[model samples]
Target chain A: MTVTLASLSQQTGLAVLDHLERSASIPVVHGLQAQGDLIVIPLPVIASSVKVWPDSHWKDVPGEGVELLRGAAGGNPHTLVADPGTCRWTTHVLDSDQLAIGVFETSAVAYLLHPEHGATGCPPGTYVIRRQREHEGQRARLVAD
Target chain B: MRREAAEIREEWLGRALSTLPADRPAAEAAISGLYHLIGLAPPRFHWVSSPVTALTTVPPGIRTRPSETADRVSAWPLPSQFSSLMRQLCLALDAQVRWGHQSMDRLIRQKVRSPLALSTEGSLRMPLLAAHDSRHRFQSTWYDTQCVSWIAHYDALRRAAGVLFTPEQNRQLDLWAAVARSGGWWWPREGACVISERPVTMRTEVCGDDGEVRLHSADSPAVRYADGWDVHAWHGTRVPSWVITDPSVQRIGREANVEVRRCAIEHIGWASYIDQAGLRLVASAPDPGNPGSELRLYDMRRETRVLLAVNGSVERDGQRRRYGLTVPGFLDDPIAAAGWTYGLSAEQYSLLLRRT
Candidate 1:
């Protein structure tokens, strides 16, 4: 399926709902996750939530949170998602070889990966799992079957 | 014949002696003429015997001392021979004068044309030249009597031959001899002898800002500083004005003061420094009372002076030179300021600053 801002925004909204259900605290939506070469979420949702969070805290959360989620996802059977103001992830596999991941702020999935298993050689790729929106909204996700 | 000549000589001598003091001027003239026959001044005589004693004794014979009894005796003959010779020559010239056949010049030339030998003891002999020039010969050579007398007195023969004492010469000789015998003579031949123990005095005067002048008597306890060198401030404070110890620095300081004063009525900065090359003296015109300070650089060996700079480059005589390595801080000490004021050696600059 084609990755799109609308799909990413839907995924981010679901990620925020999961976080709120788990903690029962409103997750402060700072900004959309920015992955390399993609605007993960549609722009309208990220812009709309930016108003609710303090500028300082909001600026720090999205960039740092995306990095944590990417780390949690690891490399196998991982699902990554972002909304306009939230990011989420889950992973279930590990190898003797470790993987390196980086998260960046963007309107897309905002994740980057290399396939050399953290060694000397690998091909690199980036993808958007969600899109930011001008208002608070759900995020989209990508799943490896 | 010989007896008759002898008798004539004796008669002449007697006449000459009678004409002496009694006709004092003529006698003096006659004595002067005799001295001319010789080539020297008349002999000064010393009396071996006191005149008073010699006159009072009234000896029957010529009162001669036995050779063995006398303490000393002159090798030359008695003064009588000199007297006899002068008298004979004078008598001859006198006759020539009476005859009026020849000029006085002719008379003297005829008498003194031959050189005479003056003998002293057995050793010294001097040749007496005739005073008269034969080329100028004239009649009645008796007019040359003056020359005859002078030569005769100076002739070595007469000096070697004791001088005859007139009573006056005898008295002077007697006094001198007594003084010499008593060992009481102390006459220096030339120059005076003085004894003094006073120390030399040097005074220094310094003008203060308050218009009061402080005078330092250098004589008391002088603060002497070496030029081109630095002494501690404590040492300098004792003196009236700072004494520059280094000759080179001292010279530059003196020149700088004079030059600065002449630049204008404004306050002028003067300074000196030394380096490998030589001394440098620099002056700048500034406000009066707040005159800019001077800087100097001196080369000790070459004794040269050059201007230097301080905080900024200083233009001296239309040229700008950088001050020494240490700047802004160097300005604090007068010596340092002086040094920095002009790019100068540390020693030279410091010395000048001390003076300020």
Candidate 2:
């Protein structure tokens, strides 16, 4: 299935969805996995994201809430992504719903994987696009019966 | 486009392999070993709040005044281990640049002028070219590879930290970042090494009072400055006051007169010349309003103007007359006559020998 950031932003509410169509001299999207019609690339996948996450401990994030998205932006609230460089593997497993909308055509994906293009590595074939509740926050404490 | 560490390592080793005549396996293994060691500790980032003190409006030449208020500034410290890794990596990088120079000389001798060199030997001393060049080829390539790898990593780190600076901060930060990029080659001499475990911002520590030892009024002796006699001095907060005074005189009817008391002291903002009796003679004070904090003293002559060094050193200039003193008849040696100066220790008398 094919996807673009415009469609992803409708579902995810992230502005980074808008940049998916822009072309870069270096391929930002190394590879992609499908979740029905959705295309998901890993969060903080770029070398530049190393700055946003900085340390190994920040690799794991909690939920796909607005608060989480804002924090990931590193004070840039308008977007959900920092400037992307070449791709690298991340231990972080972000939900497909949380990922910004984007798709790389087969040729584009091939360009990224090409040795000359200097893509770090390709993402795995399948993605675990688990769906969670829209508002995954703590419930009010129940009164004792 | 940023290349992965592996891709960079591969390209480098491939080039090295091509350059080397033999030992391909060993060269490859050595390159891999270096890669593993460097990869073991990748640079990491941290968000931290550090104490910062800001100072404004510093007087020129004087150290800036340190502020009293405490400020919390956000800063990122490179991982502690990275500092050691950086030093090691820098030494290796410097070695690479050195090998490049070495190879150029060898290439000229072995390839360009080999025939000429053979003719000069005259069958007496035959020079055999060693196979060491092949090994150096691998090492040279490996070092170059590591340099590229390190540069990429450092560039990434800088990019990651790029947002920390605003436009104004960036202009200054870029200057420092440039220094930091070349910083891998900077190594201190063998005796002293001060390594910082964490990244730190530059700071100036200004004190309200210049740290100079004040002399008690009683320690100063009275002195008279003669006209055409020059008093040179260096003065500042940090300077220690030492006055080296030499008095010269022409023969009088009975006693030697104080003709010229030439003295040079450390120029602080203010300095003066006094007679040996600890009396105020001539004062040269720099204008406090002048930002230069000028450390210069002018010639002074007069008994009333007192020469005071807040914390300064005074020294005798070379022109102090050597022949004016009369030698005792008992001291027969001409060397002693030339060396002897009244009121000086043997050590001081020896120092006067250079004048002769």
Candidate 3:
């Protein structure tokens, strides 16, 4: 079945901009993709710098969705959604940059949705979700686009 | 319970940031009751338009000793007694919070109390503290004692969570709540009590999960008092009026406080700041993992560089936004500088990935 933004939003009970093309099917990218301030990276690609704990407690992604992160000023949450049991998520991970928000492993395609960013599909795989950051002066600050 | 606590928290925050004319009689009565609780008669009341005026002017008929001067604002014994009285009241109310409601109390503390405290710090207390004779030199217990957060905490405990308070505790709580709901800051002396009126106008932006707010206005003073005292802020950071009304590259360069400097630069827009400040170009590279986005690095100042990157996503108007991040000057590669922001090496960040 083809998955458009409207279908994705309807399935997850999330809202997207009316201006965004809602009828076109969203692409399920097999490679790394960034959605606003969140980046999805194949775990092995950054295996040297990031690691998932061997005993990490993982939870199934619900039909409604799992909120990965919210913008610092409160609006616009980055929600990860997938068919129930298709994706599992865990926040237990180590990153040298301290930017990793969590790790997700999927048996089938999963999607990351944001009100402003629309949605992007992640093909079945294990990936590390990292937040984007910027240095203000000497200190690094997370980007909440 | 958490939801109701949030409602009560917002209600108190509204009172804390109130701009209405102070309820003179209500404030006087509550303060007089507080004075009586300490076994003393209410002192003569004098009202000022702002905390600055309250601190600077001598209330009529009062001569301050060296120790009782506004400079020693936190050292006043009257405030200390009131602080003790509030603590005692909290202990009494806390005891009434049964074991079942103890967990609810803790939840309210986090959801209601803590966020309100932060909002008060940002919107009200900080301004009051800024009005102190010596900035950053005095303890803030007296100010904290007057803050409505803790008062609202117990109020929420009773009204929202259904926790009970003794009649006496309720009476005492009513007095404190009335004071909070009625006026602004206060300074008590043996024979005279000075209080401040609320600001004539104020502006703020909600900046937290629990509806917490901070002083913010792009064009004028975020907070303004009837007596002409006012404060400007950018986002939540207290800043000079120029930073809001007339931010200049030279002024941003001269600012010593990094947060204030950052606010100025942001007010000018990062892209414009880079151009106006004449930051030197260091390097440029296509950002790895985020295709189509280019990273450009510029030499900002001593030992620090700025990385300019394009956001991966398109905006509602279909334009991509550009933002800058300061980085160590030693990194010559823009991609590496971008990677460094996430505490990763260039190679680690270059992995085939996707950015929206």
Candidate 1 lDDT, B178-203, residue by residue in tens: 22222110111011101111112212
Model 1's DockQ score = 0.00
Per-prediction TM-score, please?
Answer: 0.12, 0.17, 0.93
CA lDDT scores, all candidates in order: 0.25, 0.23, 0.85
Task: Supply the global lDDT for candidate 2.
Answer: 0.23
Any runs in candidate 3 off by more than 4 Å, and if so which?
Answer: A53-55, B1-3, B69-72, B133-138, B288-293
DockQ of 3: 0.55
- Native contacts retained by candidate 2: 0.00
Q: Write the per-residue lDDT of candidate 2 for residues B1-356, one digit (tens) a residue.
A: 12232233334222211212223233233323322444542111111111010111112333211331111001111122234454554454334334334444333223222322222111101100011212111222211222323443332333422213245333432332332232211111112111111112111111111111111111221111121111122110111113323321211112212211211221111222222233322223331212222212222222112212111111133121111122233333322322221212233222321010
- Can you give the lDDT of residue A108 in candidate 1? 38
Query: Which portions of model 1 miss their true places by more than 4 Å?
Result: A1-145, B1-202, B209-211, B215-245, B248-272, B275-356
Top-DockQ structure, candidate number: 3
| Candidate number achieving the greatest TM-score relative to the actual structure | 3
Docking quality category of candidate 2 according to DockQ thresholds: incorrect
Compared with the true structure, what per-residue lDDT tens digits does model 3 show for residues B209-287?
A: 7888888899999899998999888877888788998999998888777778878887888899999999889888887
Q: A-chain TM-score per prediction?
A: 0.20, 0.22, 0.96
Index of the highest-lDDT prediction = 3
